[model samples]
Target chain A: MQETRLDTARIRAARQAIDPVFLDTPLYRCEALEPGLGCAVSVKLETANPVRSFKGRGTELVASLLAGDGRNAVVCASAGNLGQALAWSGRARGLDVTVVASRSAPAAKLERIRAFGARLELVDGDFDLARERAAALARQEGIRLVEDSLDIETCEGAATIGLELADAAPTFDAVLIALGGGAMATGVGHVLKELAPGVEVICVQPLGAPAMTFSWRRRRVVTTDSTDTIADGVAGRRPIPAVLDDLLVVADDAVLVREESIIAGMRLLLEHAGLVAEPSAALGIAAILEDRDRFAGRHVVTIVCGGNVDLDAYHRWIGAAPAHRS
Target chain B: MQETRLDTARIRAARQAIDPVFLDTPLYRCEALEPGLGCAVSVKLETANPVRSFKGRGTELVASLLAGDGRNAVVCASAGNLGQALAWSGRARGLDVTVVASRSAPAAKLERIRAFGARLELVDGDFDLARERAAALARQEGIRLVEDSLDIETCEGAATIGLELADAAPTFDAVLIALGGGAMATGVGHVLKELAPGVEVICVQPLGAPAMTFSWRRRRVVTTDSTDTIADGVAGRRPIPAVLDDLLVVADDAVLVREESIIAGMRLLLEHAGLVAEPSAALGIAAILEDRDRFAGRHVVTIVCGGNVDLDAYHRWIGAAPAHRS
Candidate 1:
């Protein structure tokens, strides 16, 4: 397997370069959840920041680098989170950010992207069409085209979460990451394998969109005709080549969970942990629920990657029945 | 007005005596909430800690002091949050805690009190009866009796929150604090009056339990026959004399909100701020909605004091109708 470019030394010092708001997120052990999971479960809540997601760490580092390098403009394709993150990070560093997204993206995320002072371009089609538009726009404007999982700076920025988790807890059996563009999974895995070598790094993906899962298992890039999942954060129709290489190097195991399980996980997080976790953020909890026996009696840590779920959709998807009827 | 025992000097240095987890909570500015409040709104999320409440700050500080003073045994009457908080804090300090609660107290809080390893005594009446039983038990067992709003140490500890908020933002028009047993309200008020004197210190209470509200306005203790509200955290039929004195001296204004407004505030917090605030914690938002003109075009800060609502009752009280019906 080819070596990944993520560095542990840089992750050790990443906190200094990254924004303070994204560092030292709450790592809470909810005893209420132990009975359900049959294991000691802790959540590193990454949803309480300015961007309400873990994307800020990497985005901040990259935006700071751009500021130092005198690159004043950039473009990126986002489902929602990365766009908001880059916009916030860019504004903080006085850099111009242009975010391209599908017109079908959730208004909750799009509103935040615009609120953060980024120029938003909405394509008529899907995420791939938005990506192509972003690439074309970057070339036309003579600016950089930023992609989440493919950037070395982004990966190294994400590694800081692993750096923090290792420093916070002395030991845990495993750490679960929600598998999406593979930036968080591969970046966190790289840090844990080096700092907390005893930990087993696990990646969880929705069964509906499991390109990374298939690629990691088959040892090559995997592509699907289309993605169909409610968890837009973890939905990938085609796996990036470089992210595939890093996923193989970082993850010890990969699990695919059904759509219902993802909804159940989101509910569990709300009921037990007293937090609102978006569908993609709850993928770890779903994986554990799918195979309770495997995680039983073991201590585990999971990251709540975001909390940008549209309230109306959240209530519908989480099986929120009318209390009067119940 | 009688002088409050809360000291600003101690509050500025209180972090040294408190647990690191309860300090420096997330202060996020949500743009979506801005339009609703007709002003910039920032939330100091005090619910993401181990106990899921701001109670940890005072409880931890008092626990440390008790440990230092060689008081190994203590008893307190709690409606749930205080019991759970004392249990967790006592365990950390190697002190024994006995909690007294009314038999009708919510099972969610009772379960957590027991989980924290506190010896719980159940009374057959209301919170007033529970307090009486706790006092009787303390006399019989020869242990110290601790009451939240009556204790100077608790108030001083709560003041730390105000110190941090003042340090966080250079200025804001006002701050809204949910008036419960008045520990947080008085403690935070004392610090802000000392440091951020220009900022308005507004206390919010439920219309069903307006003892503190009336007492603050009258500059004397007030008592009510009964309390009826969904916000148990702020339900007080009889105001503590010491706390009433502190309230009169600290609070610039007091607002009473109806039951429906409190529920609406809880919903606003969930939808706009992306948080699960119990009825009491959402009082700040309730006050804003009650008189939008008062806070219009101003930057205000509010504390989400806790997130310990029972999921089933939460759904019922929040008017969570089925999506299909909508």
Candidate 2:
């Protein structure tokens, strides 16, 4: 995968696209968290949104752009929260949205997405197949696809989160994000590097699905033999070449956090921070906790990406004895 | 308990005396929540603090007042989250804080309070005895009492949350608070009424310990014979006379909510709102969901008081099946 260099102009456009409604959330310096991480840790609590995820920023911006063409129908394929976000954003603007998902998607999320007035297209296959089907449907209907990855506009929209982060807490030494399709990390990193030139952009992946990290190191698009992690949101089998290139070009560091760390991160965010972050959202913090020495005394920001986990799954995950990170 | 009859001046004084470190939280309208509540439901999300509970607001305010008198020693009696907040606030201000708690208090919370640099005074008896011992120690040492109930400074501190709600949100028809010692209700209600006269204040109590509700109905303080519920926060045997007086004067309604509703509320807040609120914080929402017809179309706000629940307790409660309210 060749690096796709991103410029400040694209980031600037993203900022304009996501102003007013998309807020610059608080860059809180967590004193308690700082000591443990051995760094002056500041969290960009992306979970503090009306939709409870940083995905809302991207979805809202994308929806606004799509609304301009007088085409009301939007389509997307998601594991859970992204679909809910698209439906919600579309509903807010009086637009119709269709979300395609596999049967493996969490029931609560499917119910919620439908409740947000989105028509559900259930695919017999998994997420990749669902994405392909949704793309085809969007093309057939000439509807706007709020695609999770491979869309420049969507990545630009996601980048606005980084723009907001830079504006809110400019003195960040490093920033962390969970890498799925690499849309969030690429977008956020592009904006942050342009705004704060020397700030380190860190991307975290679930150990079970460390495709982005491996791809970045190998300098080639490589898929894992099998992807298995509790953090389904950041679990992706195929690495988008363009998005991975963009992520590597801007990211200063990348790490893979274990499943146990993800659970611990979820508990910490919920118990100490009063945030109900999904497993994907907790990935960045989980990485930090796993290797605290690497981030000590540096003003760091991490995104709590989404909050769309099944309660039953969450109960089992947090309740069971944590699996040791081998 | 006779109504204290606080005028605008008293409420204003309360607001002024409280420290500004604890932010005036947002009062966002929950469009999703409006369906069941029958009214425009707004939630004052006090769990958005660094400490993730409304207790930070009151604790900071009380700590500031104690520090102003040059008293280094501060003492409070709490089950969990409150103790942590007090310890953190006390530590921040360079004051020594002593937290007295029973053995029933969660181990995690005790550890957290200690982590925050507070001395723990574990009692052999229950919460009531622990509180009594704390009060006695405070009196003996002449240390400032950062009491949750009955302290003028504490009530004043808690009142700032109300001021923020009135200033942030649209004028509401009613306000709901999960009542324990009546500090939160008294403080918040006092400000809401002063700012918006049309607003009616409502206090919600767990059926297991209906001290505030009982007192509101009987016009006198009543001690419960026995109390055991999922909501450990609002399990106080008796209401503080001083704050109860304020509740009587300002409150327009008091309702008892079932424990199941509290659990449901916690789950909803976590699932829908992406907030990890304790059962006490969920009480107001529980009341609204239990009798949605009462809240129809009227602008209503519920204070999410605290988020210091034990993980095991939270898992057990939220995992259970919903029960029909009596």
Most DockQ-accurate candidate:
1
The C-alpha interface RMSD of every prediction is 5.5, 12.3
Candidate 2 per-residue lDDT over residues A264-318, each given as its tens digit: 7876675556566789988878988998878776777778777766766765655
**Model 2: colliding residue pairs:** A38-A296, A38-A297, A39-A296, A39-A297, B38-B296, B38-B297, B39-B295, B39-B296, B39-B297
| Candidate with the greatest lDDT versus the true structure | 1
In angstroms, how far off is A120's CA in candidate 1?
2.9
lDDT of 2 by residue, B1-326 (tens): 23454444665665554444356554565655555556776777665555656777667767777778787988889867778888878888899999998777767668778888899989976667778989999999988766686876566667777777777545678888888888778877777777766777888999988877899888888887667777777788867776776888778889999888887888777656656778889998898888887887678778877776666666556563322211
lDDT of 1 by residue, B1-326 (tens): 34677878777777788887788888777667777778888888898877888888888888988999999988999878888889999999888999999787777888898998899999987677788899999999999888888987778877888987887657587899999789999999998888788889999999988988988888888888888888887777778998888888889999999988888888778887789999898899989998998899888898989899887778777766534422
The candidate that achieves the highest TM-score relative to the unseen native structure: 1
Model 2: DockQ score = 0.19
